[model samples]
Target: MQFCDECGSMMKADGDRMVCTNEACAASSERDSDLEDQFVTTESQSDDDVIESTEDANFEGKPKSTDVVCDECGTQEAWYTLKQTASADEPPTRFFKCTECGHRWREYN
Candidate 1:
């Protein structure tokens, strides 16, 4: 969080010292060991942190099942969604994901 005194630019940690980010000024200073210790990096996430899984995480979104065959695995079932990708006058795009192989494809309407 330290700034260069010469050119008023942010200083970054360079080994055991702090160096100015500005190439023109190129100011360097000794970093305080105590301050460095206080600013030491720590893990942000813990084992106790619980993360909820999204429906898309496992391709579990409500499937608009169709007879479309998968090009990768020849699977007949898939999850489909319509997305508005074009202008107002144009139709929405159809996106499909194969349930068995997770292969995705898009069709413009």
Candidate 2:
């Protein structure tokens, strides 16, 4: 008897394929093809492709998303405060505050 890789349950061979009795286990097997498709990377054929990838990785021409809008004046301006700092045991984090209305919010990684 073959075993189900997902659930470790016994699988019955049916002609050319084996089947899992558990519904969740069966669903997981079906997802492998989808996962494989996502991870398939196409190779770049020219130098222009390398330059474009480098620019993207360096965040060139990218607009900053750190600014918070002022609710009262509809202005695209705000203030920020750092709530956490990097240490031997922890990582750095930041939070923002609206300068006009004192609205506070936390930034996520």
Best by lDDT: 1
lDDT per residue as tens, model 2, 25-108: 772233243344343222423444332222113323323344566556665655543434456356535454444554545554
Candidate 2 colliding pairs, count? 0
- Report the C-alpha displacement of residue 21, candidate 1, in angstroms: 28
In the range 1-109, model 1's lDDT, one tens digit per residue, is: 6789999998888877889999999999999887865563324336333221234544456455776888999998887766677898999776787888888776776
Question: Whose TM-score is greatest here?
Answer: 1
Q: What local lDDT does model 2 show for residue 82? A: 40
- Local distance difference test, per candidate? 0.73, 0.46
TM match of model 1 to true structure: 0.44
Clashes of 1: 0
* TM-score of each model, in listed order: 0.44, 0.27
